[model samples]
Target: MNKILRSFTLFTALSAASVGVHAGNYWTASAQDGWIDGYVEATLLLSGNLDASGIDTDVDDGTVTLRGKVETDIDKALAQELALGVDGVIGVENMLTVFSPGDNDDAAKQRKLTDEKVATVVKTRLMVAPNVTSADIDVNSTKGVVVLQGKVKNDAEKQRATEIATKASDVEKVVNKLSVSE
Candidate 1:
């Protein structure tokens, strides 16, 4: 009876361990692509040497595919390198086009500056808004498109936040992903 009981206990433990391992893998595999995409975008956006306004990042099964326009060859390579530096990014397919600005260098620079200014203006407005809780909110802009993320107190606060961002100068659109806290 003792031998039988010990064998049964061991079997149960082994079965549980196997299930845990498989479950962990299943979740990790499913969620990894989205996480990698976000990481790569953040990495490219924060890179001072690269203008990521026109760059689109996509991830599939640990591979990052970069699409869109870059100012120069160096910028294209830098974008790829930044994406590859992200954790869980096993490979990068650089499909970035080198844009020839001709005499439009000044225009290109102005666009980049505008994107930065748009984000700053939106953030400042949120901070001073009486009804909005700006502490938990994050702001990002690219080519006049503003992305608002983070938590808000309620639905009213979320709508108010979006309205504030939309009113900011040079913001062509606002993508609100603010979650209401319970």
Candidate 2:
């Protein structure tokens, strides 16, 4: 019984550390969303039941929006299930399109992959940008076109986000829909 308790404690500590939480430190809203995003991505990638390469996850207020393509409807359902299983996720918006090989050729698959990559890169760049508050920003991509949505501090931040997104590889255009908060 003592050994089991010790192991459980260790596991809890590791889990907390994995999510960037330390003792006596609370998770901010943005931190929680970041953790949820990473958790959902990891969960889908590790599921082994789905391809996950074309998937992109965005978390806002505990709701996860899953975008991109999957080979089958089952894969789409599985991705949503896996995302909903994450501890902080309250809802899942499955925007995953079912890829029909007969309808889509290799070029289509490549375009989907490129879109996923663009979204990921843009989101990552926004998150790391010092002047950008990326927590409220949501990134989406379709066929190399990137869309930025949500709120930012000011026009500068919004423009900075657009510039950052436009710099991502394979981004043909950036449609900025970010509203400036008063």
Best by lDDT: 1
Which regions of candidate 1 are displaced past 4 Å?
1-104
- In the range 1-182, model 2's lDDT, one tens digit per residue, is 99999999999999988777644244577788998799778767755446899999999989999999888755676677667656678999999988753333457655664555556556756776799999999999898789999999999999999999887767789999999999
Report the backbone clash tally of model 1: 0
lDDT of 2 at 149: 97
Which of the numbered candidates is closest to the native, going by highest TM-score? 2
| Residue pairs with clashing backbones, model 1 | none
Which residue pairs of candidate 2 clash? none
Task: Give Cα distance to truth, residue 2, candidate 2, Å.
Answer: 70
Please, what are the lDDT tens digits per residue for candidate 1 over residues 74-134?
6776677567655578999999999853333566655765675566557756765799999
**134: Cα error in model 2, Å:** 0.5
Q: Cα RMSD for candidate 1? A: 10.7
Q: Give the TM-score of candidate 2.
A: 0.45
Q: Which run of 10 residues does model 2 get worst, by summed lDDT?
A: 101-110
